[model samples]
Target: MLNTQIKYIDYISKVNDEIEKTNLPDKVIEKFQLKETIEAIEKVELLVPVIGAFSAGKSSLLNSFLGDKKLPEKITPETALATELRYSEDEHIEAVGANSDITTFSIDDIEEIKDRAKDFKYLRMYLKNENIKNIEPLILVDMPGFESPLDLHNQAIMEYINRGVHYIVLSSVEDGTITKSMRRQLENIQAYERGFSFFLSKTNLKPKEEVEEIKQQVQDQLEDYFDITNEIGLVDDNGGESLQRVLSKIDPEQLIKTIFLEDLKDNYFSIKEAINTSISASGKTKEENNRAIQQLQKALDETLQKKNNLIEETKSRYSDIRINAIVEAVSMDLSNSIEEIVSVGMSGDSNALSETILEIAKSSLIVNVKDSMNDISGEIVNDFSTGLSNLNSVMADFTISENWIAGIAETTKKMITGASNKLNTIVSERKKVQNNNEDIDKTYKAVTSVLAITTEVVNPIVEVAIVFLPEILSFVFAAIQENKQKEKIRTTILTTTIPSLKRNLRAKLPEMFNAQVNELISQIGEQFEEAIENKQASIENAQKEREEENRNMEQIIQTYKKADKAITTLANNTLYKE
Candidate 1:
């Protein structure tokens, strides 16, 4: 069975070799490589590199797994350098330098290494212990934390991680929040062919309840912030055991077999077989070849159409999500502004009145300022979905077009290439323009200045209103006095005067006491107008971009149809000639 598997692998490998030599599409090459990698996993043992932030217990975890504190200079021991554990007949740790120079050292010698020896990028150590030797085909490498304060340490760690097949991400229990940088790193890793395991290290530092709480919080954060739903493991050294005990709890052998080995082997063999079949049947009779090509093209078109539809749907969903987020943010700001205005006005402290009014106006004006700016995020998602849908639809239609299915495939390849180039250009230009628009800073400064002025205008009025409370009362009394007959004066004063007094106090007090309030409102309105103007400009630019994209897509479609027609015409003419 092993021999047969090897023969099958070899045959697939040869087919891939031919495909690579030919100028096949990148997608085809990627699919071929994906298959080969899976097949190779069955024969070769996979090595995974474990990495994390500082104080994340990467070394401790490794030590626990090895059942010995032998992984030289474990993470917290002295931050000496990064260490790699591999299987070899001889047991020794060696530092390898830039020019492939290697120097042998004992675990204790790590402290003595200073300049050039310390400068070594990667440390390779062989396990001499009997227990470690029993574990087949897997090596655990402990790397320096990527976020180490030491620049050299970080650089060396990243270099090693770049070459790793799998990553074990260690995080702290106290602060389970992944920083933006860490999130980016994880996202990049996710894009590649690697398995990721998140470990909340040093669980013993906190109580069981606290640890569980932190885990839940981290899990929620990962889901909300990164959309990662994977189960995360929490390991603590303080759980009545040393590192060895903790390591024993985790079955590295099972982790390797289940996560990496089996699935990869299966995928590799399947891909290898597919590639071999495609290449072997590459050259057949013209009619037979054309028929196969047509089928493939039809399949491609249909796939493209399906993908396009999915993209459109996703775009719509994401657009809604984005718009809702914006609307909620703006609404909250507006509510807060109104609340602040009310609070400050009612405080009855004249001196602080202007400052409060100004703050309210400023807050209210800035709420929708960002909305005015042309945000292409929504449109980009929409267009991306549309483009995908169009491609898929074209592919689906082409699948049934026996006359020019092959030509449709060629046309799609060209269209995708062109679209990719155009997308890159558009993105680059948009970024440049946005970077150049330092007007946001200027607008912010202007708004701040206007808010200050608005406060200055309102403060005095608020103070006067508060101080002349009796005079304001007299004015209401006078108005009520004018409306009443002598007999009804007491009744009028009791029933109508107090209510009118309250009403006038509520209405006229804001205007009379907070005179600067109106000025502040005007300033806020101006700022809002400015923001709207800026956003309008952005909207115009976005609309222009959208129109251009639509035109380009239309042209591409027309070109494709023309090519299809020409191919059909030729095919028909050739049939008649034959």
Candidate 2:
């Protein structure tokens, strides 16, 4: 981890040193994002959220790590949950309100926090704990339990998951196998393109041999479901050593790299392109420069003219078959669980039935939408990247005018050494974003960007569940007669619940996802516009440098040579793969 940090910091420091000698424009310097990358390293935190059932020893695992200090447990309040633990010298606590306001409280005032827990979104504890400090940028969160009410906890957990946190899932060893609730949580995680480290708590309560059998069962279940990034560990009454081992498994170095590598590469490519374009444009005839500018203006203008078309097309493409299948699949999944729900109702667990069914509904829909919507949304954006590449192809043809025959453009003169050029590079203003790396990068951006906003697609279902579930449950229980046949009771519950789930699921599912789809389309358009604008600015800068008699041209080229050499030496030093 120290080495990774040092390497990036050194790389950025060297780039900054070169920037000082280079006479690049402020925009290009900002595009390099050297300072921003450093700041991001400081700001980036690995959120390790402990997610599990109501009495799943989540707090115990967290408390074990805290050692002397502990989270609010046993007496944790309803409609208010999830505690974020971070290290601070101040050693105080903060109450983040439901609407995100902050109120300060002393560590001893945890009782006060519990009294008004309903007023808080979650409690943020700043402690001087050694374990917390040892992890540095990793922040541990006791996320709301999987069985928490749909009105509150589901949305909260969903939001946190979208933030790209690693989850530590804890369940009681006594539970034998993965519970239905845990299964739903696991599915939700999988749908978000994430996996978790499973921990079995209260292991001390059971025999060692029994623990082994149960652990195997849980491990087998996870492997059956996923490709298994399982770091299955055991925690007991005392927060077991497995807590630290599981916590230690999250490599901050990898997280940091995953966060910034692609962007850093992007900046390098873009700045290099700008440098190339500047050098090439220095020799173009005023006639050739004007033609390029005209072509750029026409492209930009056409983008504006076609902005609505792009949005409609993306929304249309995503909505047609894929989203419908996902929504319908949610209904089918919920319907399949009808017997289980009927059994809950039949057993007279009326209070839990509604919440249980709600969990199934919300989880099924959340999983289905995330599984389909995120990928589809990503594919949609990658399509834009490809199309943008094609646009560059058109410009490629235009840039190949008489100026290229004389080899003024660097593309004509130089044999590029890298695997690819950027979509909106200054030099490769006429190149398409058709490379594998660029496609993957764009797809990553599309998925992550959509993820941040995709929670909107699931929130309506939760809102509907709040009002719909209790009412449907009431109808179901009322219709379920004491002397009724078992099949009749099942039919009663099914008729009552499935329609409600399907209707509500269908109602807002499409609308919400489509809304995000359109928003992503708009965002993709903005990125495209921004990229094209950069190209235009590069040309204008070239025209300015040309107008100025190219006095600094050689100096700029020297800086590029140094930068190019440095980049080549460290090209493969990054932690992320293509």
Candidate 3:
């Protein structure tokens, strides 16, 4: 196996050296991601990403794993950027910036790193610790906790996906068996084929039976959603037996071989094929070239079909999550708004009630919907960025545009306008009641106006609610006629007002809010679909160009076939030995 690794590495190095010597068109070489593949093969470190919700003991677990308090542990969102712990002969921490510049600094510089977190893309802390020596080739990546900005967290994790980084997903039994945020992250990870192990951290905070229950729950949930090969375990901050369990579960040597072996084999075959194609250099008869092109065309069609399906699946998953999250938030906000309006109606000041309803609708309700829209938009942008990053190495001229952001912003404004218009209609109707004329008739008119709208928009059950409201108002009027005390009259009105208002709102508002939220969802879906359609066109064009390039290299294809068979045989032998 060692001989196989050496031979494979040597062959890949020779192929790259040959490519450089030939000095082929850079554009042609890049189309196959040959350069990136070479770099991936040359790198020795295996990235083990530690991810979880904020304050889920990721840093503590790492500190325990290293047998050193190297990472700052404050139970806060520490290590703002993605911080990495790698094996080094000499211990030190350095910050890597966006422009590929590195800064070596002392422990005191952590404050500055915190202050300028956004500026640094990653922090690499190299250490020579005895505890981590056995896992020398493994780089433990502690991500910015999921409690960070959704975009930031998604961005960090998506980079891991593009680079094929496996994960050490952490969750606390104390927080819950699983949370909505953790589920979302896990779903995103599951989109790609990779290895991951879950650790239920902070188990000392729970009883043994409870920990067992949590572990069972996690296994059930993950098995339903993911093909998790590595089993889940319980770990505490002290990290003793649990720590050993985690270490054994994610043994660095086995992990490296499992993740990289297949990937290395794939890239190895691809690079070898590229080399063979270059060596033959366009020397084939027209008939032979036509036959090869036909084969290429068929493969391209199947690849494109699978790519489209994957893209559609990703988009659908994202949209469902976005809609559900937005709708839930809007429903809660609208329910609260209705409750606030009902509470204010008890005062019997129609003017104050109207003002309160409008305040809640325009402020809290609108803000909730807008925030949801923004979150969905951010997610779309992140997805686009992720897709484009994967493509950029192969398609240098391809670029992603943020032009849809403005359009989404405009659509959200229109949705908010629709909501405001609905609220404004109610407020305007309230203004027309004549308080100066016969007071009881005027009050009755106002009550009936509200009831009319509610019953008209919702259901007939409100009729029972409306019946009670008129009688309550009539009793208040009678109290006034008898020259009853102001306090007594006010109390009498409230006792009836509160229950009537609640009955009307419970019967009416949920349906109305849900309809509005659904409408907004439809609008957002249209925008997302449009974005996806544009991306599909781009993928088709890229695939066509790739096919055309292959068609012109029929002789090269023949050579690649021979080279591929040799590598496949060697790869099988290595796998058999393992």
Using lDDT as the measure, the top candidate is: 2
Candidate 1 accuracy as lDDT: 0.44
What C-alpha lDDT does candidate 3 achieve relative to the native structure? 0.51
> In model 3, where do residues sit more than 4 Å from their true spots?
1-7, 11-39, 150-155, 227-230, 251-578
Tens digits of per-residue lDDT, candidate 2, 133-201, equal 898777888877655655557656765675545788888998999987788878777665555788888
Per-model TM-score on C-alpha atoms? 0.39, 0.84, 0.47
Q: Per-residue alpha-carbon lDDT of model 1 for 1-578, expressed as tens digits? A: 23324433544454455444432334334533435333443444435667666667777777767667775433332344666777667777788876557889766665555334445767887776654555444455676664432333433533543345556777878675775445545654443324566778888788899888878877887788657787777787732133333234455444433333332343333333333323323323334434444544444454445444544454243334433443344334434444343343344433233333222222322222222111322232233233333333333322333323232233222222121121222333345456677653222211122222222323332334333434433433454346533334334333443344344334432332123323222333332232223222322322333345334534433433443344334324422223
Which regions of candidate 1 are displaced past 4 Å?
A: 1-45, 72-79, 113-117, 130-135, 147-151, 191-193, 238-578
Which has the better TM-score: candidate 1, or candidate 3?
A: 3
Clashing pairs in 3: none
lDDT of each: 0.44, 0.65, 0.51
- Give the candidate order by descending TM-score: 2, 3, 1
What TM-score would you give candidate 3 relative to the actual structure? 0.47
Cα deviation of 487, candidate 1, in Å: 68
